[model samples]
Target: MKRIPKSLLKKLENRKEIGTFRTLKTKTALVDFSSNDYLGLARLDAISVRAKQILTDLGHSANGSTGSRLLTGHHPLFKKVEQQIATYHEAETALVFNSGYDANIGLFSALPQRNDLVFYDAFVHASIRDGLRLSRAKSYSFRHNDFEDLARKIEKLTSASSVWVVTEAVFSMDGDSPDWKSLAAICNRFEVHLIIDEAHATGVLTQLTEIYKQTTIENHLTARVVTFGKALGCHGAAVLGNASLRDYLINFAGSFIYTTALPPAALATIAAAYEKLQDKIGLESLHQNIDIFNRSVVNLDLKQHFILSQSAVHCCIAPGNEHVKMLSMQFEKSGFDVRPILSPTVAARKERLRFCLHAFNTENEIESALKLLATLL
Candidate 1:
């Protein structure tokens, strides 16, 4: 390796001073609460088997994609999977990308033109922010989940250029969601294009059973991004939109154009995962766990410590980096896999312990975990 750079050393020193230094650790075999395998599909051998079987049935056994999809890697399976995803999400078309990061980078960096305006939530994923940083458009952040703030920002822009807006269906860190219907209505009234990253909602919110239980926001979006890595427990993501938008991405998105395509196994696994999403066992059990978790938090009087959310992700605010890390260590020592969300990743005062509920987690596990939390408080 080359000689260490002093500037890089100083940056690491600063991170340590602020208690924001990050390091990798291997996975541990504890009662789960940290991993994003919300439906526990990552542990399912059948899904892998099904993926292989599908590849065999489709006459594909390539261990690697030979090149970028635009070159030699545009397998026939891509068309089928994209169409299947489009229909499932009720979108007119869908285009697959290597990952959620790639999809977001491709969309934001390529879609927003020089004269256009791009507005995003302050707490949107880092990938989106990085994409916006690369964009030529004028961009601004609205207060998190505050539609009024978004409205005020939109009203201040006095340009004739097109406006593009983006937010997450289920925010990754906070586990809270924007009022999709209201946001969509606002975008529709303003005639601005809207995009949603459904990374955390792909399997969990499939049918949209809530106040408007029978309706989904599928038609409300100009484009939607879905990743199979979270609840779906696979790898890869897709951009959902009209055929023209798909064509535009294919043409201009350098991230999509230059990168080698996802191999047949990954594509097959995503397809199998989507098929598994339709099954009642994993997804239904996951929801039931969420419900059980909600009741447990209330019964244990730990609700106030937690951010109100109905999603698989629930956050309990810990206020300081040291304190939250200590708490997370306690949970790990007690056989729970809960992890701390440190500052710099979140607001400094809003560091939290993120509990990810899953289908494989027993009701007893949920009850015990919250009970342990109550005692700590």
Candidate 2:
């Protein structure tokens, strides 16, 4: 077997020294407070049944997408699902990608050209940052969720061929959201294109369609990246924009063009998930759990430790990697599945316990977890 380079070994050693080394663990039977299945659709048997039915209806029994979408892999379900997603999201068009990461990479890398300027929130997802790294555009980061800072930075940029602003509807780590109205207003005032990653917001933010319908937000909003993996409890993602953006991506987005298309079954599952969204029972239950969790945090006097959020994701800061990891272990021992967000993933003192609320999480479970967390703290 070949040995890894000393540089790589040193990096691993550094992670261990800082108590930030990571390892994968199999799913356990602990009470759920960690997975991204916000609407509980991932484990909903009905979705599976519906997805199978969809595949049968479409006569798509193939096990794989043999080629990229532009090649032989553009299956019939792609068009149907894309149209469904666009209609659901109130977008002019929607173009599907293999995953959220691919969607972001494709959009950011392909849209911004040389002399184009991109101003993104400082704490936007790593995928977006990676995409920006591939772009020829000059990029700058504004303070997270700070519209004033974003405006100030844009004002400093006196000249550019084109300007773009990027942010997320809901930040994954902090579980906080940007003020969409304020952010959109800033983009409109500057006459810049606006892009929002709705990976953590899809299905979870029930008001999204109505929010997009507002004329003020609709005008300068260039694109939105929505994922099926989180709230939808499925795979794949889509870029929502006008037909021209879809056409441009189909032609120039390397991530979308080069990657093999998603399998027929995955598309079927996504369609099934979208169908489930219309029922509203799961969504209602999920929001109720979120409310319960929020109330529990306050009741247990743990609100100060938590980030303010109305989303399914809620993070409680525990500082050091060792400290946060210890708290996570304690929660696991108590039969809850809360996980720690370590440094490097976040900043050193901002390490936290990420609690993901779901529709299936019972009221008792929510209260008990917070009470345990409070005692542990």
Candidate 3:
């Protein structure tokens, strides 16, 4: 084989220098705190059973989508899941994508026209950033959750081009939320379109949706992206918006157009998960666990150490990448699955230990984790 490229070697060296080189590891069987399966639906026996039945009922036993949705892979289950999502989220229409990444990339890359200007929160997800990277539109980052800075930037750009304000309902690393009410007002005053990425918020939809409902602005701003893999504890994602926006993405979003659709079994599980959550068993338990986790954080006096988050995701900032990784190993050793958010993924000083709470996490686990955190932090 030819010698490894010098440029690639240099890139690896730079990653090592910053302590941000990446590797993959099989999941350790530990108490849950790392995975995005907030409601524990990922491994729920009921979901699996329902998925099996859905596959049986469909009379199709395929193992894959086999082709892009635009070609031979538009499964009937796709329509079923998309319809359920639209109804559940109260959107005029819904278009499902392979994953949250695909949904964000497809929407961001295609929706903004050449003359448009995109104003995104500085801390939006990496996929959103990647999508923005591929777009022809001029894009600028406003200070994270700083509505005033966002307003000023919007004012500067609105006259020259159509504007889109993009933000996540809950930031992944920081476990914080944008000032959506103020953001909506600013977007309305400037006649700018507003888009929200609800990947983190999907776990606590009632709370987040209430915020949206209370916003002073009445006009349809733009769109909202919700993913199932996080809170829904399943797979896939959906873009929620007016019928026209959905149509536009179908026509223009290359990520959606060119990618193979999710398997029918996956779609069935999504529907089953939502159906289950709507009833009291799973949803109520998840809410109760969130409450328990919050109280534990407070009781342990670890509140000062953690980012204030009402959602299932919580974080304790541990400045350097090395420090955070070491702390995560300690967590793992103690039988927890917490993960470190390293620099380059986040900014240098903003590294953190992310604890993803799940409904199935016992009170003992929550208390034990917090007690450990109190000692560690």
Which portions of model 2 show Cα errors greater than 4 Å? none
lDDT-best of 2 and 3: 2
Which of 1 and 3 is the better model by TM-score? 1
Best by lDDT: 2
What TM-score does each of the candidates earn? 0.96, 0.98, 0.94
Alpha-carbon shift of residue 76 in model 1 (angstroms): 1.5
Residue clash pairs of candidate 3: none
Question: How far out, in Å, is residue 291 in model 2?
Answer: 1.0
Per-residue lDDT tens digits of candidate 1, residues 1-377? 89679999999999999888999989999999999999999999999999999999998568998899999999888988998888777678999999999999999999989999988999899999998888999999999999889988898895938888889888999899998667766675677887888899888877542422233344445788999899889999999889999999999998899999999899999889888887744888988999999999888888889988889999999999999999999999999999999988999999999999999999999999998899887
Worst ten in a row by lDDT for model 3: 212-221
Off by over 4 Å in 1: 208-220
Tens digits of per-residue lDDT, candidate 3, 1-377, equal 89799999999999988788998989888998888887777788998898889889889858888888889888988888888888877677889999999999999999888999998999999999999998999899999889899888877665546788898888888777876667777866788788889998785655665667778432645788999988787889999988899889988999999988888878888888878767634567667887898888888878877888877778888899999999998988998888999877888888899988777888889889888988888
The per-residue C-alpha lDDT of model 2 at residue 89 equals: 91
